[model samples]
Target chain A: MVLPSFSNPGAGPADAVVAASPTAPLDAFLDNQPQTFYESIYRSEAACLCILRLLPPVCRQIVLHVLWSHQTLKSADLKAFCGMDERLAPDAAEEVIRPARDRHIFLSLNHKGNKFQWPLSDTFKRGLRNALTGLGTSNSFGAPYARGPRDEVPTAEALTDYGEDTWESILKYMVSSGLTNGYRGGRPRNSVLLLLYQSGLMADPYDRSGHNPKLEALTITSKGFQFLLEDRQTQLWQILMYYLAGKQARGENAADILSLFFSLGCMQLGQDYSASESFPHMENVLDDLEQYGFVYRTEMGRERGQFFPTHLSTTLCSGESGASRSQSADDKRFLILETNYKIYAYTSNDLEIAILNLFVNIRIRYPNLVVGRLDRRHVKAAMDKGIAAGQIISYLNSHAHPQMYNHPPPILHPSVTDQLHLWDKERNRLGAQESVMFEFFSRELFDETRDEAERNAGLHLALPAKKLLFVDPNVREAIKDFIKDKQVQLRGGI
Target chain B: MSYHDPYQVKASNGTLITCDSAAKQILIHLDAQRDGPQKFIIRDVDDTHVLIKSIYVDMVRTSLQEELEKNTYDQDPAL
Candidate 1:
C-alpha cells in the first residue's frame, strides 16, 4: 500500500524526506519535486476537481480509472471498469481521451490488435489522484476543526464581489506592473514582485545609466500575453500556483501551502475563521492571501477577528469542467448579438469593456452600454492573435444580451454572424474555389443517380450548369455512392 | 252517376242549389280557422287524406300538435 512521506527534523538531515513504505510502487515514482506531496494530492483531486469544474461526469470517472492504473488500459477495459451499463464510454474515448492526449494529459497508443491503449500522464495522474483521494497531507481540502461565531459570515453576494475584486486586483497588479510604475504608481511588495518574476510573466527592464536608480520599467513577456488572454479563473489559479512555487523555493513547508490552497477551495465562502487556529503556518501567508482577495476580516467585534473566504477563494482550486469559474452566474454574460451586425452590451463593468476592446472595434460607448461593429480587419487581427471566430461567437453566446435572453430568437442576428463568417471567407477566399464533376455515359443513369443522391442525402444540388454538379458541402459523400449504385443497377438489369 | 233530382237556384222564389262534392271538399279544405289569436293556422282540413297531404305545409304544426296532445291528455288523466 502507498503511504505518505514523513519529515522528521531530528531523525536525520532536515532536507531529507522519509517515506513510510519504501516497497510501495508509488515510492520510486515520487520524484524530489518542490511540492511532491501537494502534487500527488493535486493529481488525485484531478478527477474530483474536473467533476466539480463541470467536466462531464463520464470523463471524470474515465480519468479516475485511467489515472489509477499505471498501465495503458484499452477502450474495452475502460468500458468494463466504468461499468457497461453506460453508453458514453465510446464517446469518452473519442472526445475526452483523444483530446486529453492532445492536451498532454493522456497518452494514447494503438496496439497490435487494432485497439487503443490509454493512460494518464504521470504528473496529471499523480496530481489528480492525490487531489481526489486527499492523500499525503491532511490539509488538502480544508479543516473545520475550529469553531467560529455562526453570524460572522458574509452574504453570498458580498463574497462573490469580494472574490471578483481580489482576483481583479491580481490581474490589475500584473497589467499595472507592465505599465508606468506598474498600475498603482507604486512598486508592489517585494514578495509579489519576486513571485511575478519567478512566474516569468513580466520583467523589470533596467536602464543603461547607472545614476537612474528609480527609473526601472516593467515589460510584459510573451508568456504574459498568452496568460492575459485566459479568463479570470485560470489566471487566478496560475498566479496562486506561481506564488505557491515561490514559497516552496523559500524552504517554507510546502505541504501546508498545498493543504491550505486545497482547503481554501473547500472552505465556506462567508464564514470567518481564525487562520492561526486552524493553520498555524498559514499566518505568514494570510496577508498575501488577503491581498489576493481570498479572505476578509471585520474589526467591529470583540475579538481582533479572522478573515473569511470569498467565492474566488472557494473556487480557486475548482476543477476544469463544470466547476469552472466561468460557469458561475456572477461571471456569465448578459449580451446578445443580432444578424444586422448591430452590437449591444448590457453591462457597465470597465474591465469587461477593456477586454472587449481587445477585439471589437467599438463604435460608441455609453453608460451601462457599448455598441460595436465586428469589422473584417478586427476579426482577422483577433484570429491572427490566436483567437478563433468560434471562441468569439461562443463568448457572445454565453453572455448573450440580457434582453435577447428574455426574448430569445432562433439565431442571434443571422446577418451579423453571417457577415462575420463572410469576412473570414473573404479573407481566406479558398471556400468558393472547389466544384464537383461527374461523368456518366447514359442520361438515364445520370437521372437515376441524381434522384438517389437527393433522396439519401438532403444535398442542395445546384441547378445544372456545365458538366459539374454542385452540392452542399456536407452531403458530398453521397455522390460516390450514387455513381456506384447506378453502374451496378445498369449492369444487373441488362 | 245517378242524379236524384235537377237542382235550380231561385232569386225571388225559393229554390234548392246543388254543388259538386269534390268542389265542396276543396272549398272546405281551403276555408279553415283557428280557435284563438295565440293559435297559428287560418285553415283546417275536413278530409283525412287532404289533412295528411297538407301536414307538410302547416306553419303551426308544433302548436297544433301541442293542442292535439292536450286534448288527448284531457281524455286520459293517467297521461
Candidate 2:
C-alpha cells in the first residue's frame, strides 16, 4: 500500500522547497488531531499504510526503522540512525524528530536510569506490520466481492466518467450559484449542501440564522472562488477535510469515518468490494460518499451490494499523479489571451464556461469556442468577490491554449497579464493608516513638535503651512511632554 | 505669548490616505461633496496624501472606482 512519492522530478527550486516539508492535506489534518484520535487511527492497517505514505521521507524512514526494534531510542541514537553529521544532528532532531513526537508516532519514555528514550506506538507498529506483511484478518484493505459472469461491473472509463461527472456537477453548482439566475443543474445531496455552507465555501446572504439554507440561497463565497481555482486533487481533499470537520462537529465517530477514508484511499480502483462484509456499519457514510463521487455502488440484491472505489478514492493518497492524469484528460490547454485583452477559449463544457464567466466578459459562444474580453470591471468584480490576481493569472496560464505555449515563455501576452494585475491593483490605490492628528498649532510649536516626533521616528505626516502633525499613537505621551516643556520655557521667557 | 493652550491635540480616529496625485485630487473632490453626515477628508496631508475619517473609507473607494471607470478607456472594444 506504499504509494510512490508524487513530487515531480522536473520541478524547479520552488517546488523543491515545498517538497522539503511535504505537508500533504492528510498530514495537516492529522497534525491537528489529539493523541487519542491517533490511537484510534492506528488500529486500521489501511489507515497505518496511508499515514506512512503521507509522512515526509525522513520521518517515514525513521518510523520504519523504529517499527522492528523494541529498543528505546535517544536523540543521539535517532541522529546517528539518520546518518547526519555532528553539527546538523541537533537541527535535524528539532526539525524532524519534534514533529514526529508531536504527531504521537513516537512515544517518549523516562527509562529507569533517568534517561529519556523514544519508542514507536504499539498500535501503529502492529498496524503497520500487518499492512506490510498482509497478515491481518481486519479486512481493512477491503474484501473482494465474488462476481458471477452475469454480473455487470463498470469499465474503468465509465467509473472515471461517473466520478468526474458527479464531482463536476458539484463544482458546477458552486460556480453557477454565483450567477444571477443561480445554478440550474441537479443539486447535490442535502448533506453536501450543508457541508458547503458549513465550510464557508458558500453562504446564504439572505439567511441570518444560517440554519439549513437552500442550495439556491447559497452563493459562492470568496473561499469558494479560490477553491474553484485549485487543481482537482487539492479541491477534493479540501472538501473531504471540511466533510470530516462537519462530522466531528455533529457528534459522529470521526475516527471511524477517518479510518474508512484511509481504507478507501488504499483500495484498488475498478475492483468490486463486498460492502456488507467490509463496512457493514458504514452504510450512511458510503451513501454520502456516493454523492461526493468517491464510490459507485450496485443495488442491493438478496445480500448487500458490491461497491467499486472510483479513481477519485483510489488516487486520494497518490496525490499529484491523480491530478496530473485528470488534468491531461480533461483540463487541456484551451485558452488564448491576446495583447488587446481579448480572450478566446476553446471549450464547450458548461462547467468550464461557468468558471470562465467568473472573471471574463464573454462576447459570444460558438459550438466549441468562447470569445471573451478581460475588462477592468469584470476582473475587479471577481477580485471584490474574493479572487486574487495571482489566482486569475495562474488559472489562465495553466489553461492557456497549446499555441500560446509555442511562444518562448510568458505564455499569456505580457500586456494582458500586466493589465489584469493593474486592474487588481487599482482597487488598492488608497492605503489607510490609523494615527493621532495634531492640528492648529503655531508654526513655532509645530516645528518643535515635528522635530521631536521625527527624532522619535513617530511622525506619520507633517504640513508646515497648516501647522499640523500626525504622529504614531504609541509616542503621543512623549510628544505631549515635549510640548508641555516648550510651553513652560516660552512662559518663563515672557 | 497669550495664556491660552500653546497647541491643541485632537485624538480623532482618522485614516491617512495615500495615493497618486491624480487620485488624491479626485479624493479631494469626493470630500467636498459632503454627501454623508460628516466630511470625508479630515485634512489634506499633501499633493499625494489626505487624512480622512476612518468610517468613510469604503465610500471614498466606491466613488473613486466610478470616477476612474469614467476616465479609463475600454481596450477590449478598441480592437
Candidate 3:
C-alpha cells in the first residue's frame, strides 16, 4: 500500500524510475500488534485532520526535511530542523510524524541512547519527491494542451469560481437531501461520488435516505465530518488524489492520467494545452476534472484549439500547500472581525458568506463586503455543527483581516479568541482521559515499564494513573510500548 | 492565460528561457546533455544563487515553460 509516486507502474524518465526493493514487508511490522486497549489516538481520521489543520507548515516541514534523511533524528537535531526549542522538539515531531506513520507516509526508527534516527519511508519518500518534483512520465502534474483547439481554455477566475461552485454544489446537494433540512440543489460529478464511495465516504449509496441516489445528491457521513475538518487546501488534494488513486485501482493506465494531472499544475492558466497529445482516454477525464475546478477549457473562434489549467491546475506543481505562496494574494482574505465583535468580510460570495455564516451572523450584505458580528447565538449555532473553537480560531488566523495584520500581535484579537473558546467550553468540555495499570509486581519493573512506554510512544507521563504501578495511558504510549516489548521479546532480548 | 507558442521563440545563445518579454524572468535550465558533467550558470534577478542540478536541465526548461505559459494564459483573457 505504499503509494509509489510514479503514478504509473514502470514508466517515466530513467532517473525518475525508482524500483521498489520490497526489502521489509509491512506484515512483519504488524504481525505482533497489540489489541485496541493500546492503540494510538492520533491514528483516527478526526485527530489527523485536526493536527494537520492546526499545524500545516509543520507537517510539510517535517516531511520535507526528512524525506531522504535518517531513520530517526536526535531530539536536538529534530529541534534544529524546525528551529524550535528543546521542549517542543520531541512532541512536535511526534505529532507530525505519527500521523504520517499511521498513514504509512513514513516509518519510525527506534531511539538509540539520547538520539532518534528518523528516516523517510522508502516508498513514501519516493512518492513525495515525485509529487514535489515532477520526476516521471506519469507527470501527475498535467499535460500540455492540444495545439489545435481554439475553444476550451478557461480563465483563471472561471476556474476558481467553477471549483468553488462545483464544490459548493456538492455541499449543497448533500445538505438539501433532507439530511440537513433540505438546503438546496447543487450536484458534483459522478466521479466525485465514486471517489467518496471509494474513500469510504459514501458507503452503500443505495440507502433509504437516497443519499447518493443520483450520485450527486449525497449525505455527509462521518467521513464527511472528517473531511470538513481538514483545511480547504487538503480537502482539494484529498479529492484529487482520491480520483488519481481510484483510476489506478480501476485498471486505467494511471501514468498518463497522473502525468497529465501534474502537467495541469505546470500548465499556463489561459493558454491552450494541446489535447491531441493526451492519452485517448484522457479526453473524457478532462470534462470530469473541469467539474471539480481542476481545469477549465474554452473554445476559441472555432479553428485554433486547446484548453488551459485554471489556478487549480497550475498550483498542482506548486505543491498541495495550495497558494499559501500567494499569502499576499489580496483575494485570498475573507473575515475581518474587530474587538467590538464587528465582522467585515470583503466578499459576499455565497461560499465566503456561508463560511463566515458558520461563526458569525451576517447583519446584511454590502456590495463588496458582508458586515456581521460573532454573536453568542451564532457561535453556539456553529458549535452544534461541530466547528470547534480551535478550528474557528485557526481559520480566522489564516484569513485574518488585512487591517488586523498591522496590529501588535497581528493574528487576531485575544478577546475574540478567548470568547470563541468560552463559546466552545460552553457547549463541549474536554478533560484528558487515560487508563490506569494497577498493581505491578515490583517498583523497578513499574518504573522501567512506564519509562519504556513513554519512550516508545514519544509521549510522557500526563499524570501517574491512580493506583497503577506503571501508568501508561496515552494511546500512543501504550501501543508503542506494546509493539516495542513484543519485538524485543521476539528477538530474545534480556 | 494565453501561452506563447514555444516554437515562436528562438533559443539564442545565453538567452534566458523566459517568457516573450525582457521583464519576464528567465528560468534557468542546467543542460546535462553536454559531455561529462554539464556546466551552467544562472542568477536570480536579485542575484541570489539558484541551484540548478546538471542532470535535470531539459526537464526544468520544459516544465518551466509549461508553468510560465499556464500562468501567463491564466492572466490573459483572450486565450
Candidate achieving the largest lDDT:
2
Q: How would you encode candidate 2's per-residue C-alpha lDDT over A136-242 as one tens digit per residue? A: 87788998998888888889888888898899999999998888886676888888888899899999998877785776678889989988887677777778888
Better of 1 and 2 by TM-score: 2
- The most accurate candidate by TM-score is 2
Error of 2 at A129 (Å): 1.5
| TM-score against native, each model | 0.47, 0.80, 0.49
- Residues A95-193 of candidate 1 have per-residue lDDT tens digits of 545434433455555565766566556766655566666674444344443444564556878777766765665555555544344346434565565
Better of 2 and 3 by TM-score: 2
lDDT per residue (tens digit) for residues A356-466 in model 3? 766677787888888888877777776765566666666676566677787788477777877776566534221121223233333444455556656656332322332
- Candidate number of the best DockQ: 2
Worst 10 residues of 2 chain A by lDDT: A1-10
lDDT of 1 at A443: 55
After superposition, the stretches of candidate 1 with alpha carbons farther than 4 Å from their true spots are A1-56, A59-153, A172-190, A204-216, A219-222, A249-255, A299-305, A317-331, A338-341, A375-397, A402-494, B1-79
Decreasing TM-score order of the candidates: 2, 3, 1
Superposed on all Cα atoms, the candidates' RMSDs to the truth, in angstroms, are 34.2, 7.5, 28.6
Candidate 3 residue B55 C-alpha distance from true site, Å: 64
At residue A350, candidate 2 shows an lDDT of 85
Which model is ahead, 1 or 3, in terms of lDDT? 1
lDDT of 1 at A194: 56
| Lowest summed lDDT window (length 10), candidate 3 chain B | B6-15
